[model samples]
Target: MTFESPSASGLTRRGMLTGAAAIGAGSVGLATAPAAAAPLTARGYRTRVVLAGTAGGPPPQDGRLGICTVVLVEDRAYLVDLGPGAVTAYARAGLTMEQVQSVFITHLHSDHLAEVYNLFWLNYGAPGARGNISRSVGIYGPGPAGSVPQAPGAPVQQPEAPTPGLTDFLRGAVAATAYDLNTRMAESRKPDIWNVLDPHDIELPDIGASATNRAPDMEPFEVMDDGFVRVTAILVDHPPVFPSFAYRFDTADGSVVVSGDTAPSDNLVRLARGADLLVHEVYDHAYFATINPRLAETFSRTHTASDRVGQLASAAGVGTLALSHLVPAGVRDVPDQVWKRHARKSFGGTVVVGRDGDTIGIGGRTK
Candidate 1:
């Protein structure tokens, strides 16, 4: 039951060296490593998770983009969330949108969903998306909040249907772009928008989950089961945002859990238990408190701190802990080494301080 600890160079477990390789000119490990030394490819691993965009929050950071993660199994790509710069990052990582089979949204947060529509609208019928021209890309996300959670000074917009789900969101996206979509369909050779993106609201089983008690302790439930992979979901503790989820992707090769946005929760640990990799969100309490005390207080309750991530990873018994969705994501704001040091304090497994395009190979050779 013993696990090999990470080396200073990279994460090594039982002779498995998870790449932690950066696709940009950034440090790949605790020590200085060559930039882009390992290009992203499906050759080495049976499954891999690419950190498409690492920065957290709505405002743009200096080097990193917003939060988006891609779990790749062979040629098929399953995306967890699509943030502002995810589409472009997908191309930059030498991957085409055609490779994407399904897209999962953790919550309806603007930072996590800003570019979701753009992902399909811009790419469909384009040269890169030729392969899936006839196939509909599945979009799965939380259903509508049963009732809006109360908050001070927060006026409800769209009072008729205060909270909309994935289906409604996609409907709005198409409506907002109706002019463009119609024009392209008539003038340009764009295919029917409906045929390109298929949206679904995930049906939550009766689990006593509500806007007030957002994340109740429960076993992971099956979300989707494509022939190649089985996806399961568990509610995580990101309050005021009901139905926020952490997802686990299991393939024949291995499993990885994407902790969408949450404070440390046992539900997450249970969902990610014994998975080969745990990709989790992290915030720096000290740094954010100095910048904005009010926002820091909110983050402290909703997101996991860097120092506490390892404890969750250890509790989950994940092989490696890859930190993404970083708050205060600027390279100058908080260095990678700081994240590594903090995470290492509580867990013995490998900890990867994720950069925008870093790809970590799992259950196979390190790239």
Candidate 2:
């Protein structure tokens, strides 16, 4: 796989000092620029993966944004997960909202879906983006979980429909922003939102899955096939967030898998098997273990550590492993080298610690 950061202007002394000051100030500096021709070339490859946000969880971190990724097939963009600031990051990556053909959500976590509405609402009619959405863009995600999971003896919040699916979430967004949508329709005569955006709830086959048995071992099933790419999903172990998924996109160029928040799940390994690129999430076990032991323990059960991610990639025989959705995403708290070191301990293939806008290309004439 070929890797490049779109805004890698090379370390300037001023930029170095600025980064240092931001780290000292305990603030994340996640500024990115539009794509350049050199980065987009991809050595003649047709398929590429762009890391929009690398930070995991809700709280913003230093040097990293939330978790979002874009898979590019020629000019079309298929997005996976729209975390905080993802809409802006998508634009910063030189991707026009008009190029968005489909969106796949891994789960309903706030950090993962924070900007789901913003992506569409903001891009619907921006300058140079108006009247361009002729085809419906499909947004797919897990359906509502039948039941909610809570800690033993803990009371469940929003017991009724505790887990809203993608369709329900989109409907709620429309309702919550009814005033604005209505005003735009009356004044600007904008196209109906439903006419452009198609939201769907991914249906699951009978595989003995449940709120408790979140990810029973199963085969990766088809979620979509839009001629350009064939998308498949499998249950991944992110407990309490039932129906959590890991998606794989198979294109003529090659295959790329996005392991949404998960532990070292066999289901993920299966979904990613033999893929060219596995963009996986990772946690800093050492950092979490020191700051919050209980939370670290909980994360260990819900997330895969750096070494475990490496093992999973190795087991899947993926050509490359790109690590994103970092738990402690701060450069000061968990440096890139630290993440690389832990992952390399278990896997021998290429390990890429992705930053926002970093592009990984597969197949074609490799660089």
Q: What is the TM-score of each predicted model, taking all chains together?
A: 0.88, 0.90
In candidate 2, stretches whose alpha carbon ends up further than 4 angstroms from where it belongs are 5-31, 34-43, 126-134, 152-157
lDDT tens digits, residue span 97-132, model 2: 677899999999998999988777766753442224
After superposing all C-alphas onto the true structure, candidate 1 shows an RMSD in angstroms of: 5.8
Backbone clashes, candidate 2:
2
Which structure among the candidates has the greatest TM-score? 2
- Per-residue C-alpha lDDT of model 1 across residues 136-240, encoded as one tens digit per residue: 988999989878876799898888999999899999999999999999888878889899789989998799999988998899999999988999999998988
Q: Where does candidate 2 clash, by residue pair?
A: 28-62, 28-63
Poorest 10 consecutive residues by lDDT, candidate 1: 29-38
